[model samples]
Target chain A: MKDKKPMKSVFKAGAITSEFIGNSIYKHQTKTSIGAHNIFLGQVRADDIKGKTVSAIEYTAYEDMANQKFHEVRESAFEKFDLTCMHIYHSLGTVKAGEICLFVFVSSPRRKVVFEALEFIVEAIKADVPVFGKEIFEDESHQWKLNS
Target chain B: MLITIKYFGQIAEVTQKEEEQLEVSKGSVSGLLNTLNTKYSDLKNKDFQIAQNQELVDLDTELTGAEIALLPPFAGG
Candidate 1:
């Protein structure tokens, strides 16, 4: 008999799912774009605090609010930035301190706008999104980062 | 009724638990916070914050019959 994994998806899965969708949508929209595509992937760094290595980072979010905020960010980016496509994804579960947790992808008809748009969207996500991360040290101590 | 309040990050460390829904009369956000702080003295010194309905909120916000969420000054990338 084959063992079945948990059938119900949790909020953690929702964030990853949306992120995948966002990337897929961007690819579909920009299939005909004829310029540079810049992507920035934010990996969790192992910050050395008092000689302890950052073992992992735990992310938690008000999922409902996060989804709403993400949608709004997408809409505003589309309206304000002259870009062929863009995508943003963030992890909602435990991400190893050195693993990638956030990804920002942008493709545009011109390289200049794509560069600018990447900066804008990343800053907006850091400032406006309701996601939170707790850094767990090797010794099990933790500290929260204020998206700075 | 006890409304379990969940604490995270620094808040959780101070509170020593992930959640604690204390008994309070359905009241404003400030009112609920006041009672909570009065009970949890450790929360008094922490630079914590509040969230209602999954969004950060100010102190004066009303919460008569809404899902209240409390958060500390956000820490995310």
Candidate 2:
């Protein structure tokens, strides 16, 4: 059976706060059927480039396409794994170093499914989404970040 | 035909604008790229992919008067 369409917005302005993350986890407590939950958080790193350190990442995206791609990833994951639920949130605008930029949470009745599904969703997001990031240096200069 | 082209991220920076409309004769995606390359010389040096109507298309793909977007390298997590 096809999964229901994902109606939630995956993009959030600025950073994904720990409070928000905590609340999300708290909300999932009522789903007693879900025995395992796996979470992946992507944090911005302060990488030194030519003696300049990255202070923040300014993100931008073709919003319509990104959302569509996110939905496709979710659907594919559900079809491949027996997941109970999954959530993905990505930050737009400026996210400071050490702040969360991406969060992927997956739940399943079994631990193995959650583990495999989380990695699949994360990898798909990195490779397929049209979101872009500009690395702002401490010197005020900036460079585009390429997925490696 | 009048085609609307959207630019994102560093590609937008190089173009110095978010989007533009151009009147062009019937042509392929490569033909559109040639026109844009002439209009914005800086874009020639950048690496990017082209999306037509929100889906990635080959340069040889014919222009169907769809919304075109120039997307830079994805760094999304």
Q: lDDT, candidate 2, residue A126? A: 95
**Backbone clashes in model 2, listed as residue pairs:** none
lDDT of 2 by residue, A47-80 (tens): 9988999999999999988998999999999899
RMSD of each: 7.2, 1.4
* lDDT score for residue A40 of model 2: 100
Residue runs of model 2 more than 4 Å from their true location after superposition: A1-5
Look at candidate 2 and tell me the lDDT of residue A98.
99
**TM-score, each model?**
0.77, 0.97
CA deviation > 4 Å runs, candidate 1: A1-30, B1-6, B14-27
lDDT tens readout by residue for model 2, B1-77: 99999999999998999999999789899999999999999999999999999999999999999999999989997
lDDT per residue, candidate 1, B10-44, as tens digits? 77777777776677786678888888788778888
Predicted complexes: DockQ each:
0.55, 0.91
Considering summed lDDT, which 10 consecutive residues are worst modelled in model 1 chain B? B64-73
Interface RMSD of each: 2.0, 0.5
- Which docking category, incorrect, acceptable, medium or high, applies to candidate 1? medium
* Candidate maximizing TM-score: 2
